[model samples]
Target: MPTTLPVGDVTSNGRTWRQSYAEDFTKPAALGTVASVYPGMGLYDGFQDTSGLGTYAPAKVLSVADGNLDFDFHSEDGRPLVAAVMPDGYAPHTTARVSIRYKTTVTDGYKFVGMLWPSSDEWNDGEIDWPESLTLGASPRPASAIPGTYANRHVKYDRSVQVHAKTDTTEYHVATTEWDTGIVRFYWDGELVSCTTEAVPTKPMRVTLQGETWTDHGAVPTDASGTVSVDWISIWN
Candidate 1:
C-alpha cells in the first residue's frame, strides 16, 4: 500500500522545516523487502536491510520490511531526523488532522524525540517548532528522562506523564498531532495525551521527524541505549 505523506498550511519565518527536503521525496521510492545500513558494519550491502533511502542523509525512508517504516536516524549534525515535505496550498484556515502509527526510542545512551512540521512549499517542504511537547508513557516533570523542547521559540507540547521507555528495549507505540485553526492537539493511541490550543501558527507547514541525544539537565539518562522506529505514517482529514 502506498502511504500518503500529509502536510499543512503552516510556516515559520518563511523557512519551515522543509527548507532541507525536496519535492516527490515522501512516497516510498522502494517498496517491499529491502536492506538497511548498520553501525559497526557501516553501510553493509548484504545485511538484509528493511529498505534504503533513495539517498542517505537529509532523507530517511519508511520501509515496510518490518511491518513498519523504519526511519534509520543517525548521529549526524544539523539533520537529526528526516524532514520531508508534502503537497502545499491547503485551504486557508482549514483544519487538518494528521495522524500516524509511529513510535520512537532513545536506547543507546542518548535522548529520543520526534516532530510534526507543516509548510506551504509546492516542493513538499515545511517544519514548525513545537510550542512544547507533553510526555505521556514514562516521564515526569521538574526532571524528565525523555525531555521535549524546541530550538527556535517553540516549546515542547507534552511535558510529563507516565510514559517511560525501558532501558535497552524497543517500544512500539502510536503518536498523533491534531492541527487546525490556531491550535494543535496531540494524542497517543486514540487517547487525548496533550493539546496546545493557543497561539497557533498563522501560516501553512509540513511534517518532520527529529530525534537526538540530549542531556537531562546534568542528570542520569532515562533512556540511554537510544534507538527508535515507526511502523507506519499516514494523514487524514
Candidate 2:
C-alpha cells in the first residue's frame, strides 16, 4: 500500500509522473481556529461554505494524529459542523495527477468529496470531482463541469460522462484522478473506472478535500456524526 508519496518518478497508466507535492500528516497538531494559518504547507485551517449545507470549522472538525488527517463532523447549535482543507503555495496545475488514500464512516445526510476546483473561483471555468459521494456508502463517482456552463447563477455539466465504481467508503481506498490536456480519468484502487473528455477542465485548478452535509436530500439529524480519515495525498504535474 502507498502510505507516503513516491520518492522519485512514479509510473501509472504507462505514463511517468514526478511528485510535486505531498502530505502525510505525520506531524500531530490541532488546528487553532477558523482561518488560522497552519505553518506547514501553508494550509488554510477554518470554516468554509463548500456545500452551503454546513459550516467547515476546521478547528472543531479537523486534526492530525497518528500520521493521518481526520475530519470529524457533527452538529452544533442546530447547524452541521463540517470540514474542508486546501493547500497553499503550490501553483494550480493545468495538467496534473492526484492520489489520495482515505476512508469514511457511513453517516446519513453527509458526503465526502475530493475535487480539483478552479483556482479563479469561477464556476464557468470548470471543476473536477472524483471519489465524490452524495451520501456515505453509496458508490463513488467522478463528475466534471465543462467550461462556460454557468448561467442564471447556476452551474451545469455533462452528466453523460459521469461513472461510478462499486466501492464502499468504509474501506480505505486509493482514489486517483488524472487530468491531461483534454481528457480526465478516474481510478479506484489502481483500476480505471471512468474516463471523460467532454467535461475535461482546461484551466488551472487546486485540490480540496471536503466533508459536507446534505440539505436537499434530507436534513442532517442533530445526532448525525462521522469521521473521514486521509492517510496521505500526493500530487504530480
Candidate 3:
C-alpha cells in the first residue's frame, strides 16, 4: 500500500513537493531471499540458463544489519542482468519528481537508476537516465546522451537531457528528475544539471534500476564485477 507518511521534501522555485512514495528496503528475512519486492515495485528476472541453472539472479536483498535492506546487483557468469521497476508507473504532464539514493562499484560495466518506459527490450521511449554510467567507447559515457541520440521510430522526435555526476558513484548520492508538462530537469544532490523540453516522454514510465556486465550489451566481458546498492527510492508531487 502507498503510505501517506512524510519521507522528505524537495523545493523548487518556491514550491515544496512532499514525498508520495518511499521504499526504504527493509528485508526482515535472510539475504538473497526470493520474496516480494518493495511495495509498488516490480522485479524483472532475466534469462534462465539452459545448463540446469535458474534465471538471471543478479539481484538480491542484503541486510544492512541496521534494520534496513539494500538492493544489491552483481554479475553472474556475465550473462543477463537484473532490474527493479515501478509497477504503478508515472506519466508526463504532471509536476512530479522521483529521487533515488544509490551507489555502485561497477568500474567497467553499466549501472542505471532512473525512470523510463523500457522493460526487457527497446521501446524507443524517452528516459530520464540520471546517475547512469556506461563504459563502452574508449571512455566512460554518461546516460545523458544527446536527445534523439537513439535511432528508432519511437525516438525519432524524442527530446531529453542529462548530466554527468561530478562525484564518484562508489559513494552514496541522490539523483532526481523533476518533470512537468514541457520541461524535465535532472538534478544531483539538489543541484540542477540539465533541463530540456525536447522529446520528453508522453507515456507513463516505471522507475527503473539496473546493473549489468558489458557482455549483456554485446560488449566483451572483463573480469570486472560489482554491486549497485539502492538505499531508498522516493517520489513527490
Q: State residue 185's C-alpha deviation in candidate 2, in Å.
A: 0.4
| Model 2 lDDT at residue 50 | 52
**What is the TM-score of each predicted model, taking all chains together?**
0.46, 0.90, 0.69
* TM-score of candidate 2 against the unseen true structure: 0.90
After superposition, candidate 2 runs with Cα above 4 Å error: 1-4, 31-38, 41-51, 88-90
Please give the distance, in angstroms, between residue 22's alpha carbon in candidate 1 and its true position after superposition. 19
Which RMSD values do the candidates have, in order?
11.8, 2.4, 6.1
lDDT of 1: 0.35
Residues 134-204 of candidate 3 have per-residue lDDT tens digits of 63111112242233346654344323353455666766667777766666777777777667777465545
170-234, model 1: which lDDT tens digit per residue? 34445555555545555554555444444344445444443333333332233233334444444
Which pairs clash inside model 3? 158-199, 159-198, 159-199
Off-target runs (Cα >4 Å) in candidate 3 are 1-9, 14-18, 29-34, 37-39, 48-81, 87-95, 118-125, 135-160, 215-222
Deviation in angstroms for 108 in model 1?
A: 4.8
Clashes of 1: 51
Winner on TM-score between 2 and 3 is 2
lDDT at 59 for candidate 2? Answer: 76
